[model samples]
Target: MSLRALPILFLFAAALTLTPISGLAAVGLAVGIAPPATVVETPPPPPPPPANVWAPGYWAWDGTKYVWVPGSYVVAPFPGAVWVAGHWVRGGHGWGWHDGHWR
Candidate 1:
């Protein structure tokens, strides 16, 4: 490889390594404002499809407003996996959402 190409290759590799780190940083940002009270709604019965799990929706910060995401049935990521619903918790900086994950 040419000498100039080596620097470019190094930059490309560095960018690839840092891309996911930046994405994770964004995902971990905590909202400083407390979301409004959650709306109570009765979820409809599960669909006829088997292995469908209920993912209860919550308010999501849109960088401008708190948008309500309605609950719905979703397919579990894997067999025997349970969906842990996301929730907002009080933190040092007002409130932040703890993202849900499959358990």
Candidate 2:
């Protein structure tokens, strides 16, 4: 290739790499590499309640982001009550976490 054409080739390569492409409906694309993994942190235990069962804290999925809801004791949702721990689930190429509940 002649010197005059070298600059054009370089510009074309740059444009190709810089172009953006959308990925999954719930996720977006990154050029040349996948996105970094999200680190999930375990929350501290809730303060002791008056003769109440303890509920584990977990991350909750908001429409466009994740929010943390603190755990607390409350009246049982049903006659017989139990606490279910919250967990993060893999969805749409990302993690969708469900908050804990006391029932």
Candidate 3:
């Protein structure tokens, strides 16, 4: 391959890798009817194992009804990373879920 073609190939590869990530973010941007607020009961936290952190559960829409996911301890994907709890936000049309991410 020519030297000039190498940069174009690298750019093409980068675009391909980032396409799926951008598409996933777009999918989460869909707005839907707001779900009723759920009152989550706090359960006593169990002893955490080494290098694990407690992830609080939240209500999720299952396309038919809201389901409560129980909280549990989750090991961090990488050192110094923290789990951000998911949340429902009010949008122009209704409500949407912002999935949690490690930061």
Candidate 4:
């Protein structure tokens, strides 16, 4: 409402236009910025039995900027399941998350 607040509001809007996505898929979260490129991570040695699949690192939006979520080994849901990495997608509203799923 005041002129002093206008600059702060503008800065927030600017930041959104240069950053990443929603906060872990809320009911309806949209981000104006496109996510940064995916981080290249060399996965560590596989863990013990049943958890050998490496879900590579990805950039996650933390309501502000993109944060690097390190890759980790996870157990496959089924006998021979393949892991599909999640990524950012552009939609009518804005950028949103396409959560990774098993194949």
Give TM per candidate.
Answer: 0.64, 0.37, 0.60, 0.67
Per residue, candidate 4 scores C-alpha lDDT tens digits across 5-87 of 99999999999886644442444667889988777888776454875688998887777788889988889888899999988
Model 1: residues >4 Å from true position, as ranges?
1-26
Could you tell me the lDDT of residue 77 within candidate 2? 61
Q: Which one wins by TM-score: 1 or 2? A: 1
Candidate scoring better on lDDT of 1 and 3: 1
- lDDT over C-alpha atoms for residue 23 of model 1: 30
Whole-model lDDT for model 3 versus the true structure? 0.75
Q: Please name the candidate that would achieve the greatest lDDT relative to the true structure.
A: 4
As a whole number from 0 to 100, the lDDT of residue 29 in candidate 3 is 57
Tell me how far the alpha carbon of residue 94 in candidate 4 is from the true structure, in angstroms, after superposition: 1.7
Residue 66 of model 2 has an lDDT of 56
| TM-score ranking from best candidate downward | 4, 1, 3, 2
Deviation of model 1 at 42, angstroms? 2.3
Structure candidate 4, residue pairs in collision: none
Model 1: clashing residue pairs?
none
lDDT to native, each model:
0.79, 0.54, 0.75, 0.81
Q: Which ten residues in a row have the lowest lDDT in candidate 2?
A: 26-35
Score candidate 4 by TM-score against the native.
Answer: 0.67
- Write the residue-wise lDDT of candidate 3 on 1-103 in tens digits: 9999999999999998876564365365544766566656564657666678777888876656677887777899988889998888887777788887889
The CA root-mean-square deviation of candidate 1, after full C-alpha superposition on the true structure, stands at: 4.8
